[model samples]
Target: MTTPLLMLLILTLPLLANRLVGRTAAPAATEAAAAWGLGLVFLFTASGHFVQAEAMTQMLPPWVPLRLALVHATGVLEIAIALGLFTRRWRTAAAFAAATVLIAFFPANVYAALQHAPMGGHAWGPVYLLVRAPLQLILLGWTWGFLLRGRTPKRMPSRA
Candidate 1:
């Protein structure tokens, strides 16, 4: 709930600010805002890895090896993806990376939901999937719509 709201706020506030300043024609501003917003979302989620390490570890299935280490590694990866999104050179790659990470982590979410893991929202039980699944899809769509799709590579000049 709060996460989605935060993402929306971060993504929209910049556009609103730009509009106030009369920078309406700049699509780059929109893209920058989206990237920054998504980056912040990742940073926020990553904080949970360290701040609630025990609860986060419970999100994983027992079969998963080195769950705590995996959680910490993913936290680092999210931080990296967040930083990468801030740069034009890496934005697309970071978006793709983010999408992959989102997909990769989803099964754990499902597991946690079904198991009613005693974490933040997961404790809500299997019904939590009702919210989590769509949120996951929305995040994926955001990555694609704002960061990945329609970005063509710049053509080099002809030697002629």
Candidate 2:
């Protein structure tokens, strides 16, 4: 829903801006857009950790400890990772960290959907997975395609 739309908008806007400016090369612009877009997405989701703290806490099983603390910690992590994506030196590591975080948090999404945790759209029940799962895959693909892929490897020295 909103998440996907935000992702799409943020992902494209940079490229559009670049097109208008006609300054940066296309490939570099594309990479910049991707990183900026994904980083913003993480920041967006991280805000939910505080804005919807109780619902987020409920997403976890009762057996889990320090749910609120965990939510806040993850929020912080997302913010840090998002910032890291902005720098060339840290972009790859940030993308990898973002992917890892997404994978780690997915089960909580499943738990929330199953329990009908009364958060955004989770009330739709198991059917929600149909949408959620695909979105998760898309995020992972976005991370890989944009940040992880196309990295140039070091060349071996040529013998004379």
The prediction achieving the highest lDDT against the true structure is 1
Per-residue lDDT tens digits for candidate 1, residues 1-160, read: 4655676676556556766887765778878878887898888889999998889999998998999999899999999999998888889888889999999999999999889998878988889888888888988998888788986545568999
Task: Estimate the TM-score for candidate 2.
Answer: 0.85
What residue runs in model 1 are displaced by over 4 Å at the alpha carbon? 1-3, 152-160
> Which 10 consecutive residues of model 2 have the lowest summed lDDT?
147-156
The lDDT per prediction is 0.84, 0.82
Give me the overall lDDT of model 1.
Answer: 0.84
Quickly count the clashes in candidate 1.
0
Per-residue lDDT tens digits for candidate 2, residues 1-160, read 5665676677557657766787666666677778888888888888999999888998999999999999899999999999988877788788889889989999988998999888776777778888888888888898888788865434458998
| Candidate 1 local Cα displacement, residue 58, angstroms | 0.4
For model 2, the local distance difference test gives 0.82
TM-score of each: 0.87, 0.85
